[model samples]
Target chain A: MRNCISCQIKAKVEQRNEDLNAKLAFLTMPQPASFSDVVLFADDDDEHPVPVPAHKAVLANRSPVLRAMLDNEMKESLSGTIKIGDVSYDALRAFINYLYTAEVCLDQQLACELLVMSEKFLVQHLKDFCQKFLVSNLNLDNSLSTYTFAHQHNFKPIIDAALTQITASMDKLASQDEYTVLKERDLGLLLEIYEAYFSKQADTTMYI
Target chain B: MRNCISCQIKAKVEQRNEDLNAKLAFLTMPQPASFSDVVLFADDDDEHPVPVPAHKAVLANRSPVLRAMLDNEMKESLSGTIKIGDVSYDALRAFINYLYTAEVCLDQQLACELLVMSEKFLVQHLKDFCQKFLVSNLNLDNSLSTYTFAHQHNFKPIIDAALTQITASMDKLASQDEYTVLKERDLGLLLEIYEAYFSKQADTTMYI
Candidate 1:
């Protein structure tokens, strides 16, 4: 009886060590391919991996605030398409990945996309990023685009922030003759500055 | 014929003014119960509003990087659930709202949420805020929680950063008898510190 008990204990230890090895192997494995068919294998016996509902998965994966915002915007916007710029397809893909894995790779384009999406989703971090990106990349050309996009989206605060950025850039540009001529002819810049300054005045008046 | 033409021009002017008034009304009005709904209705019925697709709307309303991260994680984890903190939810929602409306209210909670969600979504500004928050809130209890969470999530750099924070706090705690006694009894803390320090050493050795 003692010999039988000792043998069982030995077998259990071996099994545990094997399980640990398997787990380590999984952790060390290289990431799979991007495309579904090439990377993941669909179970032959089952239609799906887990029988969890799609909506539940989405809810579980998405932030409650983002889900609410998406629903709200979908309800509110007559046009469903929200225009996003300075954000590429890859960056969008990366953000989605992070939502799932809590992991992400940051880059310039990804940074821009993160900002635009954050603004669209009412994600504060993304908006701050967009603001910072606009502020950091504030220049004659980009600022104009940022200003126009913010206004078009009715992102008044972003518009205001971008406008402030543009105004600051404009101040710097005003010192140069080339920028002055460019600002005069650039209808986008002119409109952005006018809107930004006026909004600021309006905001101050409301507070007063 | 000349009188008729003049009358037609006046009618056109009246229509233009009416259109402008409607736009002004929209701008002046507090956000309608369904702002996106109004926009969607306008886009469908009026020539002025552009058509936006549902999927694109989803994309536009989400942080691109976050969205991408979500997608990637969805593909990779396939069956994993992400546990989000309270702060992350707030930031994500605020950011999403900004994306849709381009306006944000910066409150302490909102800022903290944004920071947490940014780290989750891999948004730079959010990450920066998370770092800033960590730096500002550097203390034994908070750092311990931060370190443990960061480690669990496999946030290498963040874990490293948090470790530095933990060490600094530990240095302070080491002087206190209560902390040492607590540390002896707290298995979770002991395990966490052991694993963190050992893993870090392993990483350093691998690099070497």
Candidate 2:
């Protein structure tokens, strides 16, 4: 007799796994190298726009912002070309690939860029993915930069996390090169750091 | 301090969950109600086939048979109409929906029909899903007919499962109306059952 052990439960797990695998097979689209209705060009490609072919339906389905842009009789819709400014070709390609496949390899830099693009395009799922990556990877070295980036983008979780990290290690705060840069470039941001540090100290003292 | 026991492991699980959720979101397409490049009609809809709109790219991706029909310059491809014979309109719609979403609420009859269709289309994933459903739902009541259906389609798993169920309840088999019908309609299948029964007896005798 087949042992009535972990496999009995594993059978259920395997069934669910099969269901998701089928769904994924149904949903995942291979990058459309043909029959493309529109093309996207990176801003850096000025002399000749490097074209990235895509289906309008797929683009519109993934992003409401893209849907609006393509659905309306805009200049881009009429011309069949979308010129995306202030982005590298690599980032633009990854962005489109993620829209189609939702798979990307991210470092700190790529995550920041994708997060900004996800926000601008109103792809909330991608934005959340990037935010989670950034938050999980936070450390002393990148805390100040992440805090500033989070502040600029109104990322509440990242702001809270970066603030916590920055204030927790305030003993060496004044000796860092970024400390001088922040003091000179944005005194308001520097003062906010002081506020966070003092507030954390007061909270600890109260607990004691 | 937050408990470390669960959080340490939960953080990894949550990351994986987030990845899957994002992929699902990217892959789950809304039904293409408009801008469909191709239309499928059930063969029964002779005069005015109730058109089920779909994209060629999606159709081609899901089924190699559909891909071949759409990719080559055929009459259906030229006219942008595909006629699917020997299927109900409801089944055809559900088939297309499953191709899009990989989801369906199945009954025995529906599962059989879909298994046949999935096989015809060479969609192995859907074929396996329908086969598993039919195999799991097999019982003495349905085993004879299920056996015949599975036999016709050369579905080995279902055939084996139904055969096992049918042979186990040989005492009640002669009383069923399906047994009488099988005797009249397909004598070969009836003889095969006797062969199976005797073979099982010999095996049991050997074990003893």
Candidate 3:
């Protein structure tokens, strides 16, 4: 009986892994198969843009923004083409691929790009993914810039996380190059960091 | 710091749930949207079969048999319609939806139908799902028939589990109407059960 129960657990885990791999493979099948209903181009200004073929049903199902765009008699829906401005082809491809399979290889730049795209597309899952990645990878060097980016999007969790990182290293924050940029462009954010840092300092002093 | 770490874990769980929900909703978008490239008919013989609209990419990606059929210059491919014979409309819809979302509401009969279809289509994940369902639901009443079904497909784990159930209740196994059916259709399977029962009985005797 014990052995049978253990086998069931093992089989369940195996099936889960197979399910994930199958969905991951589903992402790869779209490129070469040529059944895609729509083509997405990155950076509409580029004279010769690389087009990524995708299914409208998949894109719409994943994102309400995409659904609204495709569901209505919009220019994109009429033309069977969507032109996204200010994104690299690789980032666009990665974003669309992530729609098919919730899998992406994230570096700092790609994560930021996806973060912006997810926000734009109203894809909360990808937004959460990119936010978590950015939050975990935050350090003194990137905290100020990340905080600014998060502030622009009003991503509260990321803002709080970045503020925590920034306030923890207030002494070194001023010496960083991003500190100068943040102070010049967004003095309010720098002030918020200072307020947070001094409040934390006061709390520590009271505790002592 | 501890609070932040706990928050991150909570956020991760939330993100995973959102991801799952997004994919689940993806399965519901094919109907009435009209973006599907192909339609599947449950049975070919019906004069007026209800069409199940589905993306060819999704169907092809999930099952190698479907992929082979769609990728080649076959009748189904050319016609952009697939006729899955001997499966009920509900079962076929659930099967295709499972391919998209990896979610299904299974009953014993539906599980058996899907198990056969999954094996036919070489979809191991769904096969595992149905096999586990049947194995967990196995009892003395259904043991002989389930064992025979598993034997037909050479599903080893289900076969072993059914045999265990059958040999444990040897008295009940012989009295059931399915036992008579099994004896007539496949005497070898019946003999194998008898051989297993006696072997187990001998082991108990040796232990004593």
TM-score leader: 2
lDDT string, candidate 1, A112-133, tens digits: 5666666555545335545555
Index of the highest-DockQ prediction: 2
What is the DockQ ranking, best to worst?
2, 3, 1
Alpha-carbon shift of residue A78 in model 2 (angstroms): 4.1
lDDT of 1 by residue, B37-140 (tens): 11111111233433221121222223444345336445313332222334333444454443333235564445445555555554543455455555565456
Cα error, candidate 3, residue A12 (Å): 9.7
Candidate 2 lDDT by residue in tens digits, B36-155: 678999997667779999888778878889988977688878899999999988889889988877778999988998999999999887898899899999988899999999988899
- Candidate 3's residue-wise lDDT over A42-85, tens digit each? 98346898888998878887788998999868999999999898
Candidate 1 positional error at A194, Å: 3.7
Model 3 DockQ class? acceptable
Off by over 4 Å in 1: A1-61, A64-88, A101-109, A119-125, A136-141, A169-189, A195-208, B1-208
Cα shift from native, residue B169, model 1 (Å): 30
Positional deviation of A157 in candidate 3, in angstroms? 2.2
List DockQ for all candidates. Answer: 0.01, 0.47, 0.26
Candidate 2's DockQ is: 0.47
Interface RMSD of each: 23.1, 2.2, 4.6
- Return the candidate ranking by TM-score, descending: 2, 3, 1
Worst 10 residues of 1 chain A by lDDT: A33-42
Better of 1 and 3 by TM-score: 3
In terms of lDDT, model 2 sits at 0.83
